[model samples]
Target: MEAINISYRAMIILYALITVPVLICFFLKLGNVKQILIAVLRMTVQLAAMGLYLDFLFRFNNVWVNFGWVILMIAIANITVNRNSGLRTARMFLTVMLGLTISAFFVIVIFIFIAIRPEPFYDARYLIPISGMVIGNCMRANTIALERFYASIKKNEREFLTYLLMGATLREAALPYIRESVKSALAPHLATLATLGLVSLPGMMTGQILGGSTPIVAIKYQIGIMIAIFTAITVTTVLNLLLSLKVAFNEYSILKRDIFRN
Candidate 1:
């Protein structure tokens, strides 16, 4: 069965629902009604624009065009990760971009080629959405990992230095912080995975079901996507931190304060 479309009137009603929260915020003097309205407006405009662009992309479906869009997504995600992680964009851009691109494409290749294998192998429909999901997760995970890792070292500089002075190698000194950062980055996803179906339905599975796929098919796709997301996040987070070592620190094994955006 084809999914039902939402008419403009229906969509307007849905948008009207935002006022519920806005009213609550105003009554409580929370002072974020304006922010909420702006956020809703931005989301509406961005999704509308994206819908149009995605329509064109699906029709064009050229391999070069598809890969180009994926690259653009990766670039945007890379910039966002750096900005949110409080890292100087220019300093970590290339390294983090490399990590994200590698991990995202690695998982996408396996997921699309081996698992789904859509006809034409590079079908924009399958490739683009999967890439977006994987890259998006990588962006968030990398942000947490990078932010926590650097912040930990900066906050515990004396302790970090003590590890170094007491015969620890650079990697050895950074190991504890790395472990903590990776764990912090992965924890939310792990919890989500554990509570997935019991707590709430995931977007992919719900979308697939609404789009007319069998429940079994939707569940399988959701499982595949979740695995892909987790793998991409883990690889990108660790690879980003490891590759960044060359630029994040000096030859003398000192963490560079200048790398931070502040």
Candidate 2:
């Protein structure tokens, strides 16, 4: 299949259009123009670099290089999740990484190896991109779950302790916060699924269609991907919060301030 190509002039024009939001923000005094501009610039640079690297990866098709690239993505995602969730990297990095890697790997492998079964099983074309998508979403969900779970526990420390004092087990005491955090983390995915066909065309399905797949085939792929994403999120969020309890609290079952980013 021939890949679509965009010329340099077209890319420049596309980049120029990004400033419309920045300009509007400046006039509206939203005070985020600088941040918006910087974010756009960073996104452009990062995506450009990733595209180039992916092109090379596809060309080489080396198993080791592909595996290493996936690992690198997981590592970068680990740091990003911790940093964004306002957790101290030194404390939660490994835990977050483990939660994400385990769940994402499980879902991706099952889908690629058992379900999809793209030839060669470890085909970079299928394995890397699908894993990247699942892992990226899992990282985000776990970060939110961990952050909110710990934050809620700390915010309601008195209530949490009261439950423990009242003879509730640690799991029982943490259940409320865990429920809330899990709901909060999963809400976006639920909402997306609800409005999926009406509000917007999903990127993955659209890409498949554009890449020469039939609409029915694209829909099937979309369904499979969504199932994988949902499974990954559910497993990672629960496991992440469950695992986080070990490090997030002291012997007294009290949250430790040292675990936060501040």
Candidate 3:
């Protein structure tokens, strides 16, 4: 397969395009100019670093190094999940990490190793990008699940306590929150799936076709990636939210208010 490369000078010019939106925001007084600028700047820097690292990783072709890189991505994602969920690093880090790593690895291995049977199981080319995509999606789902669950419980403390006082077990009392949280996390994906072909072209499928894969082959890969994404999101959200229950509550089965950041 041929590689598609872009020049660094082109990237700089592309980054400058962000200023158009920043100027528009300034004139309209929408108050998002700084935030938008910072976000674009950070995205540029982060993707640039990842691009350089990926170039080295593809060149090395070392199994252990590739595995190490995947683990590092997972760890960073784990931390991001906790932070985004408003959960403290001290309490929920390992559970989120374990849940995301386990769910992502299971799905990726089943798809890439057993199904696609990519030549080297740990090939950086396939393993790194695929695992990154899976972990990245799971991170978003888990964050939403965790945050919404805790936030709902806190916002409805009286109702939650009523359930407990009405002879509901901790698990029973928390089920409503669990259902709502999972729905909130997965609803966007469901909507995307429903309007997929009509609304927007999916990035993965577009990339595959642009890389010279046949339309049929690209469509199949797109279907496979979507299935993996949906499955991983469901598994990670449920598992992480379930695991978080252990640390999110007190002896009386009430969510602790102090767990949230101000």
Candidate 4:
């Protein structure tokens, strides 16, 4: 039941497989051949570098190193969420990080630590990947929520202002947009969760199976991770948007124009 290693030659063949799409893009004048190649090259370089560092980290397996790496990932994710969501980076950085940290506490402490309890508790192989999954999904959800919330209020400023003028509190006026953004951010994850096994074998389950876990065991882990991801994304997105109301608005409840980078 041991997994077979992929040889370097197999990797080279995989890289070569991209040539078909590269040629098609070239002939179609897609003008994205360079972009495609750059993306692939970046993916290759990043994963390769990560592979080396992960090997080092795994070998050493210090508790501090593992937790520090998770913190770094969250910090990076926080910044990206701020920048992409059009929230002023300096203004939203600490707020975003706090939201992310809180969400991480829920996922890692409750699910990973209490439920799974992988040996050594700080095992990088388990902690790092699970942290990455939780943090990464939270980043995406936060970006969507913030962007939609702010953009909606900005685009419908008159409507928002009218709501406030009608004696509605700031929270009441903002509730509509907040609900919309949360719904928008959560829709895809919901659909994916619904169709998980029916549509396709989830990547984590597939990887675990390939790594020689029994199919039933892999499914259990997959279910746990999916629940972790969905919950993390929901809590992070809602918390971020709620906190953002303070950071993104003026005392009079106006969306700050200067907060957007673009």
Candidate 5:
């Protein structure tokens, strides 16, 4: 069965719903209506372009092409993570790129080959979406982990130095920061995992159901995807931090002031 398509007129009506918030912002002097409208327009344009590319991906469905796309995605996510983490991209680029690529590729290979096992094994429909979900979550986790971690160390230079001066190795001294970063980065995901079915209807399951998949099937797929997402985020966050340690610190174990960009 085919999912019902939203008409252009229906989309216009849906877009009209934003007018309420825009007007509210306008009256309250929130000064973001222009930004809001621009963001909405950008979202429309971006999604339209993505839809076009996705159509091509589905049509071609070549194994190498699919993997090349995933690699491109990994590169983009790496760049985005570093850019938003307030870290100088040049300093941490290779570490972030390699860390995320390894984690994402490892998880996706296991997930698709051992778990999902779609036809042809490299089906774009399966590989692309799953890779996106994994890479996207990993990106967010890395951003939070890196930003919180470096900011914490930078703010606690005295304590970090004290740890170092008191006979702690660089690894030992960074342990506390690493623990804090990993915990904080994964916290929201832990909460979401706990509250998932009872409090939330996940998008994957909802979309599957809307696409005429059985509720049971949708739930099963959602469970697999959630596990993959959780694993990918956790592994990528830790790997990024560990791999970045060498680049982020000096020979004296000092956190480099130049690593972070204001």
Candidate 6:
């Protein structure tokens, strides 16, 4: 069975639904109606551009090209994580990128090469989408972990120094903050996992179903992607924190104030 396509007029009609939220925001004096409209416009333009680019990419599907695209995605994700986490990009970019690359590629190798094993293992369709999913999740997780960890230490400098003064090693002193940050980073994903199908259909599964795949096939893909996302996030969060420790702190175990943007 082929998937049904929405026509341009249908899409325009769908976009018209934004008025509902815009009206509600205006009524509530939210003052974000402009922001909402701008966001919608940006999303529309970005997706349209991506759609064109992806069409070209799919047609020109070379292994090197696909691999290069994945690298680009990783680099973009790294920059975004640094900016959002309030970390100085110069200090943490390479370290965080390394962690992200390791985690994303590790899971991609298993998921794309071992599990899915599409006709051309490096098919752009599978490789690009899966890598984006993994890298995107890693970006968000690392942002939360880094922000929470550094913010916690900065806020509780006395407590952290007290731990150090009480004969704790640098790693020991930072252990509590590390645990807290990692937990905070993973909590949302864990909750989503726990309530996945019961709460609502996930994007991957829903997209596959809409694209005419059998329910079982969609479910299998969803399961694989979820596991891949979770593994990637966990590894990236922990690895980024640990690797960043080398540059985030001084030899005397002090977090460099310069590492923060603000």
Whole-model lDDT per candidate: 0.95, 0.86, 0.86, 0.90, 0.93, 0.94
TM-score of candidate 3 to 2 decimals:
0.91
| Candidate 4 vs 5: which has more lDDT | 5
lDDT of 3 at 118: 77
Q: Estimate each model's TM-score.
A: 0.98, 0.93, 0.91, 0.96, 0.97, 0.97
lDDT of 1 at 132: 96
Question: What tens-digit string does per-residue lDDT give for candidate 5 at 177-251?
Answer: 999999999999999899998898798999999999999999998999899999998999989999999999999
Candidate 2 residue pairs in clash (backbone atoms < 3 Å): none
Model 1 local distance difference test score: 0.95
Count of steric clashes across candidates, in order: 0, 0, 0, 0, 0, 0
Candidate with the greatest TM-score versus the true structure? 1
Worst 10 residues of 3 by lDDT: 1-10
Runs with alpha carbons beyond 4 Å of true place in candidate 2: 1-3
Q: Please write out the lDDT profile of model 1 over residues 101-199, one tens digit for every residue.
A: 999999999999999999999899999999999999999999999999999999999999999999998989999999999999999999999999999
Give me candidate 1's TM-score against the actual structure.
0.98
For residues 77-152, write the lDDT of model 4, one tens digit per residue.
9889888887778888888888999998799997778998989999988998889988999999988998899889
- Candidate 1 vs candidate 5: the TM-score winner is 1
Worst 10 residues of 1 by lDDT: 11-20
Candidate 6's TM-score reads 0.97
Tens-digit lDDT string for candidate 6 (170-227): 8899999999999999999999899999996699999998899999999999999999
Q: How many clashes does the backbone of model 5 have?
A: 0
